[model samples]
Target: MYSRLSLSWITSSWAIGLLLVFPVIAIIYQGLQPAGDLFQHLMDTVMWDYIRNTVLLILGVGVLSFAMAIPAAWFMAMCDIPGRKYLQWALMLPLAMPAYIVAGIYTELLDFAGPVQSVLRDLLGWQTARDYWFPNIRSLGGAIVIIASVLFPYLYLLARTSFLEQSVTLMQSAQLLGKTPLQAFWRISLPLARPAIAVGLSLIAMETLADFATVNFFAVNTLTRAVFDTWQGYGSLHAAAKISTLMLVVVVLLLALERFSRRKQKVFQKNMGQESARLLQMKPWQQWLAALFCWSLVVLGFLFPFSMLIYFAAQYFTDSWTTEFIEFSLNTFFIAGVVAVLACLIAILVGLFRRLHVQRGSDIPARLSSMGYAVPGTVLAIGILIPFGWLDHSLNDLIEHFGGKGPGLLFSGTMLALIAGYLVRFTAIAVGAVESSINKIPPSLDMVSRTLGHSPVKMVRKVHIPLISKGCFTAILLVFIESMKELPAALILRPFNFETLATYVYQFVSDEMIEQGALAAIVIILVGLVPLIILSRSIEQH
Candidate 1:
């Protein structure tokens, strides 16, 4: 009887185990190859500086993303600044803008032949770029700003949820004890909210580490880019896998830190809680200042890049918006739909199974499933490719021995492999969203179901799942958004003659054809905005 419920549990557990083990298996396969010479080559080159720069960039972006998100969360969640509700949702709008699109816009803005420099040349009589003081956008610092801008929403969403869920009584007690608002926030709020903040920061760090498109675009040699460089740049999969292994080690360390921090904090929200934390009135000047601060982040993150894309897209429409763009759009939608549905189903199972077996070291499966989020998409693709390629070879041999010949299955050449890759890569995101929502359901609902002699499946179907349908939908939406923006895995794994909007954009961008790329990029961003808005609305409800 227990095994019946645990069947789903076992399936999810094995799925999680497979997800975690595949990357390790791929790295070991690469390492077992006779490429000890590449390791020496890596040691002899600027690998140390690459490591340092990557670490520094991660720290820089993590700190900046937090610096931007926390205050905004505090103000929007706790303060009574004008348009607070609007600002709350608006803060999340930047998630719609992909990092590479942000990089492209900044690159154009800072280029000598671009608009800003051109304006300076025309208006201020500047001759050469040497005479100007504008910052270079194609550097490490630029990558930090670009990634941080789009990434802060992760922290913002998590931190704001923590802030919203704080018991009002504790805050009132802090106020009664003669603590000022800021003091109350610092002492009572931030510490209690540390779990959520830790999770958010860990996510940001993981993203900063796993990111490939933006880092590659900016020419920053992070481990992700190093994976590509070693594989494509040097034609050595062994060297690439070594770098990927190193990245996994760093990510595991960070995940451990997040779990430790989360476990240390006591969750104090009582069932019959106090009033919602009261909002304080700000002066007119303060309101405007707050609005300006929030607006500046949105502009830097979303508006500026979006506007640039609109401009370039207009040009592309005039020049080359054709049947190719339409076909790519359809392909993008089809792939995203497949990834979202599959990921959401898997995540729901994982979330439900974990909830049912709450005391059974749920962390094991949870961490393994989430580990895919930490793995770079490109690395995960390679991992999937290795195992699938081997499976195909083995299966084909067996088929030929028994019957006639079997069609070259698995990764030989098929969309199924691509979908599998997407599922493995993005199942973490769906699990996170569904798990978070499931965590909010009271334990009594399931207990009530059991008390009435309901089956475990019925208990979940009737009691637990209905409570979190919105969250499931949001998970699907979020996965859809991510699938649309996914570049590396889709680029590497797509069958011959296949094209996605992302791939179309990449082709144009690779050749410096920014105008056409901008058209496709804009479409991707617009598709992403629907989920971003949905996520924002969900946060507000909390």
Candidate 2:
């Protein structure tokens, strides 16, 4: 009985379950009203276009992500490549470059008056737009490229790990049987890694669906954008909820697909001492080709935008990057830092409890917490607003009744609410990171600790925590970067006049202030690059 109710595990799981489940309940209850009418609206007005655009983006992102991620993962995991360590981090750097920020910078860069067009015009000496046919930024294909550039790392990181953990013997035996390396990879390695790949694909699909900032920035009509138009423009939370419900259904299908794919299929083989084999040497041309591929991804995804930002910053280095920009940068860092630490701690508690409590219902909290990830940032912000508004109203009323000011603390339109939203949305990422890390520790270690009369806390501290220290740090870093790049939640929930780097850039870009926006946008990317590069290199070493 004592073992069954280990305080650390049970308490953590229960709290986590509540946190995860509450918003889902709110979303469903809110969405259920006016269902029939909402469905018709969803069916009628441009909804199909939104759905089609969203679906196409997902499909395109999926194909493109896998195409880039699989080969990169394979190269890092299996082949001898130049700057393998550098490549690992370089690939992950785009995570710091938010899709929307990328959208803003790319829009400026590709605009008729932007540098690309200017350079083209200079080379050809043709002034007018008709003289040279540069593609427009505000189009579907452009949206796909912008989003996929930043999002492929999601697939790359997961698939690389999957590739690295494949038993060398299987690949070697296949090659020994006269199969080429490519044939062996497809037959032996690819199938084995399918589960991880599926998980990655599901995440990418769901993220593509949940995206609001990128689609809106690029002027593509997606479901998330539809939700915003319905709620804000139409002043209809009911309509927004309906759209959210449909989106939830889509997310559920993705979750089901991932679960179905993973069923009875363990990606990680259990045997110890199963290390990855040596990388094969490539011909001179092959080496150059591989290097070119990696470089192209890094350039399109990270370097180009960064270079543009640097140019802007240099022009403003002694000019407009003032005390105000510095303050905004500090505030952004502070909030991101707090959210990262808080979310990680909460995730560990939630994850540990879920691990220890093996009841049939234990999976509920994990599912619920992860639902935040499925929520578009705009919808999640709106969901948070509903409860926050009620809380604020109730508190204000209570204060007036007592002839005094009530504590306007909970949702005071302050940074606090923004941080809470971040915790709710990103806690899943933290939980996932911590859970996967903890899962890697041998169960025998815990058993041994228990047998030695160590308490549960002691066991975790001495055995588990030590083992997963690097993972804990990684989780913290990942959350920090995520929060840094997060847009809609911060924009909607932040107090009047409050700003993060993302919001600052968005504001300028929305008003067509391209030059200053590019400057601030670059700052956000550089901030993301520092940690992303470090984490990527760390993973490669592992």
Candidate 3:
């Protein structure tokens, strides 16, 4: 028998769920309504270009992500390659880097005036751009490469873990049938890992779809950029909402695929397949080649970009160390801090309600709270903007009815909209962490707490809070880091003159002067590394 649920607790939980989900609902509602000529204008004009580019981007990135990840993943798990120890986790470093930052780094290096081309020009005695043909690093192809370079870790980590967990006997049986190691991997290991790979691919697609700065930087207009331009460029909420709804369709499809893939995930015994004998012995040259491939991804994706950032920052520390940097750093920390604490508290309240209350649909709030995770940030910003914009208008009008100076655009114009957007998008991360920790506590502890004459609140305070404290801290940190790095929502919803490291870096990047903002960019990258470090340590511990 579960503890009796209090009306207040239940009502509060349900209300939180509704509030978190309201933005997405508002987007749908606004999108369904008829907009003026601008909507159709978009439909007839650049809409197909956006669609074609977005589709091509997805296909190119998906195919490339698989190619980049699958072999590295296989090598990590199954081959006796040199540097396997460092390379396995080092490959994940790129995942922490924002795609735009990496794009900017490569753009600088590969551009005609940058060192690579300049050196080539000097060595070959070519005078100018017309003299020799070099691939442009600011095209759709460049965007695909930049995105896949960072995003492939999603696939790599999942595929490698899936490969590790397969039954050893399956591989042995394939080998006994005279299958080469490569043939065995293709026929057996890869097939069984499809569910995990599917889930990973879907995540890659979502991240790729949500990407804005890289595509925008490279002048490749995709749907995400379309949503930003449709709203900010033309100031049409309904038109933006319509575009957002289109993106939501893609999001929904990806999510449904992920859910189905999760259900189809296979279970197996003999999960510990990392034995030395089971590992394939590659020749010395092959080992070097395999290790070099993994290392190249690390260098291109993380090390090279990061080292270049360091060089730029060192060269331009005086320029980057400015009053603006301090202001935006404080702004970022303040906003991320507030969002983290609030998200942590909300996750605790909602998670505990589901765990202890035992009411019908108690888990609904938890489900609803995380739906925003699937929502792209640009769409979510619009979702938040619509309802809150209405609220702001209504409130200001009501105040002005009595001849009072309206707290003008209070909700929508202030940090409220920004905070709301962050909460909706990132609270799910907190909720998942907290819920996982809550699950580890045995049911008997709950019964004991209840039987000691403690009420629900008291029971949680004395028991659940302490046990889940680490998870709670992790939730806060994760939300804080995500809030810090979040670009799209922050870009759309930030108050006038407010900037975070991401937006600040983007400004300099947009102008082809990333060196000026390199210090701030380094700060973002370093902060982003915290969670990755924690994860790496945790993986090593296990």
Candidate 4:
């Protein structure tokens, strides 16, 4: 019986691991098959621009995100500022808005013909472009700001968690040695939280690298944009594959840096029973300033874009609210639901396999499976097309050989491919959630269950399932939200005439008709708030 269960665990782990890893393998293989003159043409023409723009965008977004996240995190976690309680969760609201949607809104508002600059021109009596200088919304700098505003929450969440979980004794000791609160924070708290901050920055960096819609919308030539253009614009899948491989290499480097930052860093908690550090009282002016800073981020990052969306939805209700829109919404929900359930199941299988098997390499499968979260959606879409396309071709050939008409694209262009891409992309969230929940359960329960003659499956069903139910819900909710908001993969992989809310919104945004899709964008944002609320509550409890 034990042998059978062991075999089940091993088989399931390897199967899921390979499924997760297959895209990366496919891209690498596609990248290696020589592109001949296509590679040379890219190198001689736009490759330099792609590399330069990608680096600048990553660096710009990283710096700005840290600037926005660190102080807000510090104030919310440690300072007794005015509105701190409200601001704590409000800071996380931006995570609900996709950067591209924000970009679309702001571009309209700040454009030359849009309200902001138009009003400025009317007031100044300016005739034309020669009257005064104004910043371009559709530029590299604008893309950086838009992406950073929506993404800084990644840093804030992690940094706040680190601050909240730090050993109170360390700060108290620093105070005893005559360090002021600010000095102690700078010297002790900030340094100790470096690993957490590094992890957060790495996430932001990967996201910046992965971004396609915002950059493409702005006409910036980043690597992600290059990949899309190379394949769709130039009709060169080989060149696209090469670019995807290059992007993967960059992601791997970022992951390595994150690991290095975490290396040799012992997270000392003093004791599990130790209380968190007390929040320091701020002067009245300091309180007002902190409140202003944090609230400003909340307004700019979430409130402004969300309000604009609502206003547009209201103004265009007749045009935007249609049967087609309803169908799109249903499609989004259907795909998200399917992906969420499958991700949860895979996460459970991998999580349980690692838990039950104490072998030396038992954890490798979980690690491999989660690596896809770091990969860009566009890259993953391209990666998936390779092997699945081949499968479709092989099936069609077999069907023709058997004297039956070929069923076109059995896997590649259908919902099956989209679901597979989503699972590869988001199963990490579920795996992490499940593993954390499982770790909280004592091993003695498992031993006792086994002694009672319960099979491993039955033991999990009767005990682990009920115990980790909340984690399971969280996993499902998070993956669902992510899947709903995902654009690039859905863009590439959806079948003919199929439209998810994200893809639908992207089409409107691309056509500069954002108002038409405003209602759908709002729906996506509202759905995303579920996971943000969950995260906020979880951090507060910690």
Local distance difference test, per candidate?
0.79, 0.77, 0.91, 0.89
Query: Candidate 1 on 1-542: residue-level lDDT in tens?
Result: 12246565677666765665575567656656665788678868877877898898889999999889988888877777877767878788888887877877777777777887899899989888788788878789989989999999999988877887777777778878999888998998888789989999998998888778787887888877777777667866567767766777788888998998777567868422422445655688987887788888889898878888898888668565788888889988898998898787777776777777656665567656666766777777667666776788898898888987866865636887678778777878888889989889987877777779888878877877788898889889888888888888787678889998887887766556777788888888898889776665655564
Which segments of model 4 are wrong by more than 4 Å? 1-9, 167-180, 267-277
Candidate topping lDDT: 3
lDDT of 2 by residue, 113-159 (tens): 88888988998899798776778878888888888898899888888
Candidate 3: regions farther than 4 A off: 1-3, 259-269
Q: What are the RMSD figures for all models against the true structure?
A: 4.2, 4.1, 1.5, 2.2
TM-score of 1: 0.84
Could you estimate the TM-score for every candidate? 0.84, 0.84, 0.97, 0.95
Candidate 1 regions exceeding 4 Å error are 1-21, 28-35, 165-188, 261-263, 267-277, 318-320, 345-370, 392-413, 432-475
Number of the candidate with higher lDDT, 1 or 3: 3
- What is the per-residue lDDT of model 3 for residues 22-119, given as tens digits with 9 covering 90 to 100? 99999988888986699899898899899899888987888999999999999998899999999989989998899999998899999988999999
Candidate 4, after superposition: displacement of residue 55 in Å? 0.7
1-542 in candidate 4: lDDT tens per residue?
13246576789788888889899899999998977688779889989999999999999999999999999998987888888878989999998899989999999999888988889888989878778999998999999999999999999998987887776777778889999888987998899889989999999999999899999999999999988888778777678889999999999999999999889888767531333346877799988998999999999999999999999999999999999999999999999999999899888888888887776777888998998898999999888888898999999999999999999999997889999999999999999988999989998898888889998889889989999998999899889999999998888889889999999999999889999999999999999898778777876676
